[model samples]
Target: MAEAYLLEEVSNFTTKYYADNLPSVHNPPPRYNVAENESSLSLFQGQLGSASGATSKFLAYEEWRTIMLYVLTNLKETMSYIEEFIHQFWRRSRDPTSNEIDTLLKQGAGSGKPDFISWFKKKIDLTEVFGMEVDNEDARDEVDDAKDLQILERLHLDSDDDIPPPSDNLHDYVDMHDIDDETHEPAIIDDDDYF
Candidate 1:
């Protein structure tokens, strides 16, 4: 979760830096306020470390400053590269020619098919494009005790009878005759001493 938040902050910083210093925007100010941004980040890192009890050292202030400056210097082009990289990564991760999307959104309006994002939103909402219910509605309910018992029976989970008992002859292999049982005698305590 911390990593996700850190990545989100990085993304926001990059995009904001690019938008602030874009050449087309005419006479833009300097890309960074080091006192505000760098100190805020360092404080965040310290808080994160303390909260997580992290032993790993955070980047030194100078190192972090250098990195921020480098990113700010190339902000616009860097953001464009990042955007393209994300698209390429997702394309590689999923089948480019997938028709699962088409099948999922056949009932939608105005066009031949819904896009992936719309289809995904419908999936999230557990609904079809035209407001029909999902097929496996009851399947989402928690299993009842009877159903749980049935599953346990099917899995042979109710019985410990299958497990082998410890052998009584285990002492036959190990010599225990030398140990004096009297060594474990209970100590005689005087209750009157406590009183």
Candidate 2:
């Protein structure tokens, strides 16, 4: 009926506009419906209706984007909630401190999906507990960067060898013969273009 129609609409919207980038929070915990092996269409309608029965329609993409921003931006208590879940699910053996979780969240905000997964795996035993596999490319890049930094730091130890002769500026190391200083001037624009 109406519920089925709403779910079909959501599926279509998710497929066409949102794609499959559903948040991890979208999956509700198993309940009585687990025995019935109900499809996600039913689950979405049930969850949406119970949560927002008064609403006539699901949010538009812009509205959902705004809402997602709001949710992520106001993540003061959200950190605690995630920490509690991690602590409970992983059973304290692998749970990180609040500060660690905050660091992971910030890293997740800055990095792409796989970096986020790498951060989680690095901080906690998520791969073992959740059977979540982290894609290795970013992790390998991170390790390589760390090794490069280490080598650079070692190179800095031999200051006599690393030091260069005094010059006008360090940027003078670039080959100045190829660059004409006069050619780099800003373009002159006519006043008529402004109107």
Candidate 3:
């Protein structure tokens, strides 16, 4: 049941993301779709579809690159989720508070079957996959800091300046003594007041 739910969630998420970001047509002309002509098989060929469809096959290099990037990014994120799910499942089912799960994962590393441990631990490199380098943590942080600095400069604000503390003395702003102490009785209004 859990596996089915996870599969459904992943499928829905992927479908929604593709629909929102990519072209509406699933199969573009062979000329516009590189996958159609490429004979190379990928590990995810089943999910991504094998290159055996007929369509126009003339896509611009930039457009093809963008599509590849989108697919690779989605694949990386999906794989991360799957890895986390497997880890969590193993941890909860085997040992919640012991290192047994880790031992088992390490043991599975050399099992010759799909190395779950290595796949879980290994980070995907987009550059190696598609010759396009992705920003690392440091580069991302630098870009973010540059953007923040630009925003601050545009607003004429100094990054080092501290925000003034909120005033703690309310009496300094409001004169409580000037307030009337009289308690007026409620007036009984006649119907004439409505007019």
Best by TM-score: 2
User: 48-143, model 1: which lDDT tens digit per residue?
Assistant: 222344476699965864555354334453344333323423434565333432322222223333322333332334443226544222312422
Per residue, candidate 3 scores C-alpha lDDT tens digits across 4-69 of: 999877865566457333543442334434343243434244334445867788889657645553
Better of 1 and 2 by lDDT: 2
On lDDT, who's better, 1 or 3?
3
Q: Kindly indicate the candidate among 2 and 3 with the higher TM-score.
A: 2
Q: Give the Å shift of residue 194 in candidate 1.
A: 83
Measured against the true structure, the TM-scores of the candidates, in listed sequence, are: 0.13, 0.19, 0.17
- The 0-to-1 C-alpha lDDT of every candidate, in the order given, reads 0.38, 0.42, 0.41
Q: Model 2, residue 86: displacement in angstroms?
A: 9.7
- TM-score of candidate 2 on Cα atoms, chains taken together: 0.19
RMSD of each predicted structure: 25.0, 17.5, 24.2
Ranking by lDDT: 2, 3, 1
lDDT by residue for model 2 (7-121), tens: 8778755654442333223443444322233444322234322333375788896586455534643656345435543443332456577676555444333323222323333
- The superposed Cα distance between candidate 2 and the true structure at residue 102, in angstroms, equals 2.7
Clashes counted in candidate 3 amount to 11
Error of 2 at 61 (Å): 12
Which candidate number would show the highest lDDT if scored against the true structure? 2
